[model samples]
Each structure stands twice: as structure tokens, then as C-alpha cells.
Target: MQLFGGRKQDEALAKREEQVRKLETECRTLQTSLEDTRELVRHLDQDRELLLGALEHLRPGMDVQPQAQVLLDVCFKPLGLACFYVALADWDQDLLRFVLYHEGGRFRNHPSRRLSDRSGLSERVLAGRRPVYIRTLEEGRAAGSLLTAAEQATGLIPHSWYGVPLGRGSRPSGLVSFQSFQTDAFSEGRRRVMDALTGLLSICMDGPPTPQGR
Candidate 1:
């Protein structure tokens, strides 16, 4: 009778320990989630302040390349963007030209891609005429090619990619893209900021005619 009683006691102790462990795990998860929420809130605040100053700097007469650089600068630190590019669509030629490409903390040349190329990421954005947010490069590759042959040879493969089309209607005039080495780099808040910036960029690009011409 003593032995049986002791066995029951052990079983109860084991169950209690298991419960403790589960509670500990739950606490850790909650802590992590809270920390993430705090960080996101902080970023949202910083982004808002930066954007206000950026708007003052981005004028219609400014060159496209300079404007691209300025936009990247505004979000580079806040969003962790490692790569950025602006590709203008050539509907007549069915091509997308990389007019402004920035990567590795510097500017670099990028090759153009055919709009009809189903394997390229730009084509997906153009076809949809909307923002394309890729959480990881693997996901992008599964749907279509993420990089060109030349890019594959020398470029850094980004873990996250986001592209927003410029203009509206059935066809967009261009694409502005940002990439990062970390997976899931863009949160919902970050995406909203990017979308806003891209929208502002579109207005500057297609806004009223200037003396210098577009």
C-alpha cells in the first residue's frame, strides 16, 4: 500500500512539473511578442518623422536617380533595405530598363529584363500592377526566377524582396523595388511606409510638367 501511494505521488509531481514547463514556455512566447510589438511601434514613429523631412527634399524638378537615392536613404536604416532599384517599363519594346540601381551601400549597374519573361520577378509585379511583397527569395524562386543570369553571377541574393509598381490602370509606367538580406524584413507597418513613399515617388515622376522636362 505504501509503494502504490508513493507511485501516485510521483505521477502527480511529474504532471505538476509539466504544467510548470508549459507555463514558462507561454511566458517566453508572450514576452517575445510584446518585444516585437514595441519594436514595430518604434519603427513606425521613426518612419513618420523621416518621411516628413523626405517629402520636403523630394521635388519634381529633381533628377530621377537622385530621387531614388533620397528615397532609399530615407528608409534604408529604418527598413533595413540592402538593395534598391527603379526600373522603367518600355511598353513599346516590351522591356524594363533598370534606370537606377543601388546595392551593397553603393550604386551599381543592372541589366534590363523583358516584360514578357515569365521567369522574372519584375514581370509578376507588372502583370499584377500592384505591390508584390516576397517574404523570402525561396518563395520568389518557386513562383518564378528572382534574379537574372548576370545578377546570379555577381549579385547578392536577397532574402526578402518588395516591389511597387508606378502609375496606374492596365499598365504601370515603372517599378520601384527594395530588397533585404533578412527574411520577413518587411512588417505590415513597414509595407505601409514603403507604399506611401512609392506613391509619392509616382506623383513626383508623373506630376505636372517642369521647365527641365521629365
Candidate 2:
């Protein structure tokens, strides 16, 4: 009877040891997976930084066209932007002339084109004084009346858009709008970074000297 009891105790100890070994193996596997996830996140964050947060690289006195090009190159192209437009308000407020426009695979300088009216999207965006990052263009049109028929028909219609006012506060001096042919092209993370970059863009409209470059 004494020998049988000793054997039972030994077997129990061996069973516990085996269980511990299995648990250790699972813990190691989980740790490896966690490390890999962290590394992937780190790379994504770096890409995000370069995509929108690097607007300061445009530098003061950078030509406005060059600045705009750099913005497209870094911000829109990497994220699959199809087109963009930049316009400044005339003192009369009767018109928002296109200062820089790119669409359907080309960029043009349309300093004379009258773009928006008092009730149009550009004016409304400035009046609303907030960035509108629409995940889908259909949703934007359905949500409210913004773009005019001419605005909608005159160019490459967008699938989605993210636009920001180019002035301080609700009374913006102008605006820069980016659009894409792909839905959900812009994300909240990009909007946050672009929001911070507005001041820099405003400065460039005059500081970078677009007029002299022409």
C-alpha cells in the first residue's frame, strides 16, 4: 500500500510539470505575435507622418505652385488622390478664382475662372469654418446642398473629397480642396494633420509668390 501511494504522488507531479510546459509554449507564441503587431503599427505611423505631417517641409518663401505640387506629391498621391484645387477670394467676394487646379491627369492655372457663389460649397465651407472630410461624394450631396451644377459638371467629378478652409477662423480668405476617385480615400488621421497644416498653406499663398512665378 505504501509503494502504491508513492507512485500516485509521482504521477501527479509529472502531470503538473507537463501542463506548465504547455502553458510556457503558449505564452511564448503570444509574445511573438504581439511584437510583430507592434512593429507593423510603428511603420504605419511613420508613413502617416510623412504623408500629411511633413507640410512644414514646403518652407517659407517656397513658390506657391511648388508648394502646391509638394502637397500633392506627398499628401494626395501617396493616398490615391485624383485631383485638387486651390482658390483665393477676391476682395469683392463675388468670386473665388482658381489659383491652382489639377484634375483628370493635368494641372492648370486658371486665375480668371469664377468658381463659387455666395451659396456654393466653397463659401459654405468657409462659413462653416470646419474641414469636411467626406468619405463618399454621394453622401456629401445627399447631406446638404453645396456644390453648384456647374461645379459638379465642369470637371472630373469626385468619388470622395476632403476640403479645408485656407484662412483663419470662420471667414476664410480661400480654400484648398482635395478629391479622389476612390471612396474612403481620406481618413481622420490625415484630416488632423492637415488641420494643423492650414496656417502654413495660408502663408504660402502669398509668401511663396505664385504671381511672380507666372
**Which whole-number lDDT from 0 to 100 does residue 125 have in model 1?**
89
RMSD of each: 5.7, 6.7
Mind giving the per-residue lDDT tens digits that candidate 1 earns over 42-149?
887888876796798778767677888788778777677788888889898988888888877777787776787755777788899999988887897886756644
Best model number under lDDT: 1
Question: Where does candidate 1 clash, by residue pair?
Answer: none
Quote the lDDT for 134 in model 1.
Answer: 87
Q: Kindly provide the TM-score of model 2 when superposed on the true structure, using C-alpha atoms.
A: 0.64
Cα-based TM-score, every candidate:
0.75, 0.64
Q: What is the C-alpha lDDT of each candidate?
A: 0.82, 0.69
Off by over 4 Å in 1: 1-38, 148-155, 209-214
